[model samples]
Target: MTELARAAAADPAAATSPEPVPTTPDGVPRGQPVLDRLVALLDLERIEENIFRGVSPAESPVRVFGGQVAGQALVAAGRTVPEDRHVHSLHAYFIRPGDPRVPIVYEVDRIRDGRSFTTRRVVAIQHGKAIFSLSASFQLREHGLDHADAMPEVPDPESLPSFADRVSEYGARLGDMAKLPRPIDLRYVTEPAFLSRESGPRDARHQVWMRADGSLPDNDLLHVCVLAYASDMTLLDAVLVRHGVYWGLDRVIGASLDHAMWFHRPFRADEWVLYDCASPSASGGRGLATGRFFDRDGTLIATVVQEGLLRIAS
Candidate 1:
């Protein structure tokens, strides 16, 4: 989708017709059991030795979400690796907005399989062109020295406002977007972008509590893939809040340029995790943010860094 299309989707008054309801390929409505549908999305269809096909939710946003593509790519990479190996790190770049109307084809290249580490590269293609690419490294489990920063003292996830509760103030502005099926549950410790933009010029820090909205089966790869999808939901809001500008409320636009994640320890995505995020710099029409994932016990399990295009219209 183009910039104009994004604007139109965000502005209810600009909509020319009723927004379409999302559905499954079998023509079943999809607003409930959202997590089931999400898991299905990650279940890619293998078409060749190293090629797989995945699809987007019906009537998706102007573009397929960045996290969806990233998560799906990881699934493709994981499928080609040995089950004994687990993904330790992944680096990905979003080259273009994905088209949701069609299926995405992921082509995987086995880069290396060494004594302790395995690496794979995946490219997500649509209409025979590359839209995204990722390189992931898997490792055989082994003992390692461990140390991490302590999790800051903050209110528990239950004390914070849910995403729906936080956005209730926006009223009809968000339309069905706010009401759509959400597979991930998010609660904010700080004012969200929409709310912060009114009184902010705040610090470049954002903290949120996140977990899958529903129960997930016991699968290590599935848990990690789910975490990858949840990571992109708000990692960049820290940048916008620092300037007190929002996407629709302000004359601003943004897109993920690249994302990288490192897994430090095992964790369940269905359990609450604190995502502590901050933006250290933004320049040349881009903003860079980093986040650490900590389980409820305050054990750091993962780290993420992402740079995104944040164009402010003057």
Candidate 2:
């Protein structure tokens, strides 16, 4: 097994079955909770040749995160490609809010299998209607001219405290922001939490260090899903910072409208990756942000772009 797989195996928390369930007093599975359990609810079953169906438990709101769906769809598609090939890019659209109470069916269509690259399209359906779609490309790694931009200098993840630690330190002062489900550990290299008073004029740039709470599978597909999950965390917020609006502040409302990513190289998600983000424009109550992910060795693994609905309270 690869190091990632070994690490994942070592983590006691990573072995939970992908079935949504409520946690007991010790965070072990008990029954099921409406929102919290959704993260665990993807049932994979074969439907057709080169196609699979994923079902989720019935709940009012969809229990799956958009990134999770994208990542899972990528995994389904990756299964059809050669193990040597790695994901290079993915573009997906969310057509409707997924219904948690209903199960989603993902149909993967093999578009082409070329010598150097393979392509696939995934359509996520619910209630017999298409609610999400993704197109992904995979490529085999080959030796060639290689170069990458310098990694951004940032404090190590160890030097900074986890977001949860900060929240506990702040207590009720965190307000509704504390309610956000923080599955990954995040430490801002530029702006510390709850230090808005020290924040000055908005800048387009942001840098942070991140890694999964535990190790993940060695499979490139799983790493890509982890990247997809982390990609959505702060790209939109970078735009808000450009406008001098802290998301935690009561004066602003923000939501991701669309997200896209391009994987440039293979990298382990279990390791620390430098995320450098910037916002180029914000107008008409909308904002656009772009980001790049670099491994510790300065390999540019991925590039991301996102547009979000940003409305400042009047």
Candidate 2 ranges beyond 4 A from true positions: 1-43, 55-64, 169-181, 192-201, 246-248, 251-253
lDDT of 2 at 280: 89
**Candidate 1 C-alpha error for residue 52, in Å:** 0.2
Best candidate (score: lDDT): 1
Error of 2 at 177 (Å): 5.6
Q: For each candidate in the order shown, give its overall lDDT on alpha carbons.
A: 0.86, 0.68
lDDT of 2 at 228: 86
| Highest TM-score against the true fold, candidate | 1
With candidate 1 superimposed using the best TM-score fit, by how many Å does residue 267's alpha carbon deviate from the native?
A: 0.2
- Per-model tally of clashing residue pairs: 0, 4
What number of backbone clashes does candidate 2 have, counting pairs of residues 3 or more apart or in separate chains?
4
Residue pairs of candidate 2 with colliding backbone atoms: 22-32, 58-101, 59-100, 59-101
Error of 2 at 224 (Å): 1.2
